[model samples]
Target: MTEYGRQPVERQLPTEEARDLIALVRELADREIRPHTAEEEAAGHFPRPLFTLLSESGLLGLPYPEEFGGGEQPYEVYLQVLEELAAARLTVGLGVSVHTLACHALANFGTKEQRAEHLPAMLGGGLLGAYCLSEPASGSDAASLRTRAERDGDTWTVNGTKAWITHGGVADFYTLIARTGADGPRGITAFLVPGDAAGLSAAAPERKMGMNGSPTAQLHFDGVRISDDRRLGDEGQGFTVALSALDAGRLGIAACAIGVAQAALDEALAYTAERRQFGRPISDFQGLRFMLADMATQIEAGRALYLEAARRRDNGLAYSKQAAMAKLFCTDAAMRITTDAVQLLGGYGYTVDFPVERLMREAKVLQIVEGTNQIQRMVIGRHLVGPESR
Candidate 1:
C-alpha cells in the first residue's frame, strides 16, 4: 500500500511521520527560504525570521530527544530536511547544520543538569548557535590549538582567539574548544560559552568568497569566565568530543553538498530547456546533454553515499570512514556539478544574476569545513591501514 509497491526498494522513503515533517519543511522552504534568498544575499542579511519559523515549526529539534521539545527523528530523516533546505538556500542549510553541531556536545555528553538548562533554548529558539573549534593556525590540526582555559578555583578563565567561526558574532552561544593543559588533543576541554560573556568579543566579520550572509568571524576570548559546570565533559576530553561531533557534522555537510549539486542540476536542466542555441534548445544538443548526464550521475552517487553514511550513523555503526567518504565525495561532486552547471549556463553562470555561481562558491567551503577533504582522506587512509598499524 506504500509508494514502493512492486518495485525493488532502492532505499526506503521516509516513514509516515518523517514524510509529514518533510512536507512541512518543503512548504516552508518554498515559501520563506526561496523567496528571500537572493535579497538576503544581496543585502548581507541572514534570515533570522526563517530560523524562527523553523523553531516554531519544530524543524530545528528534528534529531534531538522529544522530551526536550525535539522531534526525536532519525539522522536519516533529519538530513533529508537539511538537503531540501540547502537546495533552496545554502546559508539556511549551513546555519541549521551548524546549530545542530553546536548542540552535539550537550545532547550527547552533557550532564543531565546541563541538558535541562541549555537544550530548551538551543532547540526552541530563534537564536542560532555556533561550534568554535578552528583557530587561525589550528584548522586541520585541531589538537594543536593554543586557546587557553586556566582554572580559577571553581571557575575557568578562557583566554585566546577563535578564528573562522560560523555565526561568529551573532550566535547566542558557542560550544568552544579550549586548551586546559599542556600540548596536544588530550589536554583540550569543551565549554558552553555564552556569546555575551563579558570578555568574549568578536572581530569584524570575515569577508568570505561565499556564504557571506552566514557571518564568519574571529572571536577573542579575553579572560572569559565560566563555572566548572559549564565544562561539557571531564577536563581534557574536548578533542574527543570535537572529533565525535564532526562525524555527525560531516553527514550534515554531505547532505548540504548533495543539495547544492541538486540545485545546480535543476538550474541547468531548466536553463537548457529555455536556452536556445544552434537553431534549437541547448538541452537538445548532444554534447550538452552528455554534460548534464554526467552532472546528474555525480549527484545521484553523492546522494547515495551520504544517505548510506547517515544510515550507518542511525544504526550506531562505526561510520567515521563512511562519513569522511561521504563528506569528501559529496562535496567534490558538488564542486563538479555546480561548476558544470555554470558552464551549461555559459556566460550567465559566472555572474551573480544566476545562483549557480553562489552554489559553486558554497561548495568549496564544504570541502574545507567540518573536516577538510585532505583530513578526510587521512581518516580513510588510517581506516584502511587498520588499528594494528598504529
Candidate 2:
C-alpha cells in the first residue's frame, strides 16, 4: 500500500519538555495511527483501542491540570500535539479535541470534590467523552437549545435530544447542557451524565462524507437521572461554560485544520515530484510550483494564527475573537489546500486510491464544525463593532 504519511513539521516549542512531547506524539501517530487510517476509515470502523492507548499514554488530556491525571501542558503545546495527530488521521485528532472539550467544564468549574471524583478517569483512565450542546433546532444559536432538566430532591431528571454529537454512542461520559429554569441562555445548566445512564440512548451514527471512523449521532435523554453533585456550575451558567469551552475548542479545530491542510500539501508535493508530464516532473512546471507554494504559505499562516491565539489563551488574555478568526481562516485554508491537492494529482486525486480525495472531504467538515466560518465571521464582527442591533 502507498504511504499517505505526513512530512515532519518544524514547530517552535517553548521548552525541551514540550519538544519531547511533540516527538512522542509524532512517534505514536506514525506507529499506531497513520498505518491503519486508510483501511479503518474505508471500513467506517472506529478505532476504540487506539483511544484507549492514547488514554493510557496520557495524550487524552494534555491541556488540563496534572493534579487530576492531566498532562498540564499549555494550550500551545497541546494544540501542536493535536496537529500532529490530525495530520495522521482526523478521527483521532478531532476525537481528542472533542474529548478535551467535554472535560472543560468540570476541570475548570466543578468543585474540588467533583474534579477529584471524576476527572482522573475521564482524562486518563481510558474513558472517552462527548460534548453535548447543539440540538436539532439550535446549531449556531446554541442559547436557544431546548434540552431541559428538572430538579427534584437533589436529583435531576434530564429529557431532551442532543444532535451532532461526536463520539456520541461510543463515549463513556457526556458533558451535557440543558435548560434547568428559564427559556434562554440564563436558564441553562451543565451536567456530567454517564453514557449508560438510564434513558440515555444514541441513534445510529450519521452517514457522513468523510471521517467515517468517527461516529456522529443524536443522543436522546428520557428521564436520565443525575445527582445535583454532577452539575458543573450554578444554574444559568451552562452557556458561560459552553462558550468558554468553545473558545479553546475553536483553537483545537484551527490546529486540526492546519494539520489536514499540511497533509494535503505534503501529498501534492509528493505527487508532483513523481508524476512526469512532457518528459519532465510536473513539479518543475511553474504553475504547479506556484500552487504548491501558495498552499504551503496558507497552511503556515493558518498555523501561526492558531498558535498566536493559543499563546493568548495560555497567558490568560481574551482570545475569543482571535480563536474565531483562527477557526474561520484555518478551516477555509484546509478546504482550499486539499482541493488544490486533488487538482495537482489530476485524475488520480479524485479516486479512492489516493488520499487527497479523502482529505478533501474531511477538510469540508472542519469549515462547518466547531463553528461554521460564517458564524466565525459574525463572532469576529461582534467583537469589533458590538452586537448587531435587533
Candidate 3:
C-alpha cells in the first residue's frame, strides 16, 4: 500500500516568516492531521481538539489584525497556508475558511467596542464560529431569505432557519443574517448570536458524500434574542457585509481546491511509479505520462489564478471577478484532476484503500459550496456585463 499524503510543494512565499509558518503547518499536518484523516473521516468524527490546537498556534486568524490576536498576515500568505492544510485534510482547511467568513462582518465593520470585546477570543482564543445566510427556500438567492429579526426595546427577537451552516451545532458563535425591515437586500441585517443562546438549536448534520469530519447542518432560531450591540454594520447593511465576506471566502475555496488536486496528483504519480505492468513501471507508458503532465499543468494554472486574486485583495483592489473566476476554474479543475487520478489507479482508485476516491468526493463539494460554480459564473458575468435587465 502506498503511504499517500502531501508532498513538498515548492512555494513562492514573500517573507521568511511566511516560509516558517508554512513549515510549521507542514509539521503539524504530518504529525497530527494526515495520519488519522482516513480513519476519522470514515468514522464521521469532527476534530474539535485539532481546531483548538490551531487556535493556540495562532494559525486560525492569519489574515486579521494582530491587535485582536490575529497573525496579521496578508491574504497572499494566508491563502497558501490554507492550501497546505487542505492538502492534508479538507475538513480542517475549509473549517478555518468558514470561521474566517464568520468573523468578516465584525472584523471589518463592527464598532471598536465590539472588536475589543469579541474579536480576541473569536480569533485566537479557541472559539469556533459559523456563518448563517442561506435558508431552506433561499440558497442562490440569499437576499430573499425569510429569517426575521424583530426589535423589541434594546433586544432583537430572531426566528427562522439557516441551512447548510458549516460549523452548525459545534460553533461557539454564529454570524447570522436575517430580515429586519422591508423585502429584498436592503432589509437584511447581520447579528452575532451565541451558539448556546436560548432558542437556538441545530438540526442533525447533513449526510454528505465527503468531508464528513466537518458538520454541515441547519440552525433554528426560534425567538432567539440578542442585544443590539451584537448587530454588525449599520441596519440594512447585512447584504453588503455578506457579499464582502463571500468575495474573500471564495479565494479560500479556490486555494483549497488546488490543494485537493495537488494531493490527487501526488497520489497518481506515486502509484504509477511503483505499480508495474508487463514487467515495467506503468509510468513508463507515453499515454500515462501525458495525462500526468496535463494534471500538473492544470494544478499550476489554478494556483497562479487564485494567488493573483489574493494579491489583488491584499492590495485593496476590486477582485470579485477574479475571485469568482478562481473559484470556478480551480474547483472544476479539482474535480477533473481527481477523476483522472482515479483512472490512473485503475481498480485501486475505485476502492477506499486509496485516498483519491475520497479526494474526488471532497472536490465535488468545493464547486457547490461558497456559491455554486453556476453562481460563480453569474458573478463573473455580472462583473463584465453588469446586472441583467428587469
lDDT of all predictions, in order shown? Answer: 0.87, 0.94, 0.95
Write model 1 residue lDDT over 229-341, tens digit each, in one string: 99998899999999999999999999998888888888888888888877899899899999999998887888888888888888889999999999999999999999998
Candidates 1 and 2: which is better by lDDT?
A: 2
Whole-model lDDT, candidate 2? 0.94
Residue 196 in model 3: lDDT: 94
Residue pair clashes in candidate 3: none
Best by lDDT: 3
What's the candidate order when arranged by decreasing lDDT?
3, 2, 1
In the order shown, the candidates' Cα RMSDs to the true structure are: 4.6, 0.7, 0.8
**Model 1 TM-score relative to the real fold:** 0.95
lDDT of 1: 0.87
TM-score of each: 0.95, 0.99, 0.99
lDDT digits (tens) for residues 1-390 of candidate 2:
365546799989999999999999999988999989889999999999999999999999899999999999999999999999999999999999999999999999999999999999999999999999999999999999999999998999999999999999999999999999888889999999998998999999999999999999999999999999999999889999999999999999999999999998999888889899999999999999999999999988999999999999999999999999999999999999999999999999989888999999999999999889999999999999999999
Q: Given candidate 3, what's the lDDT at residue 189? A: 93
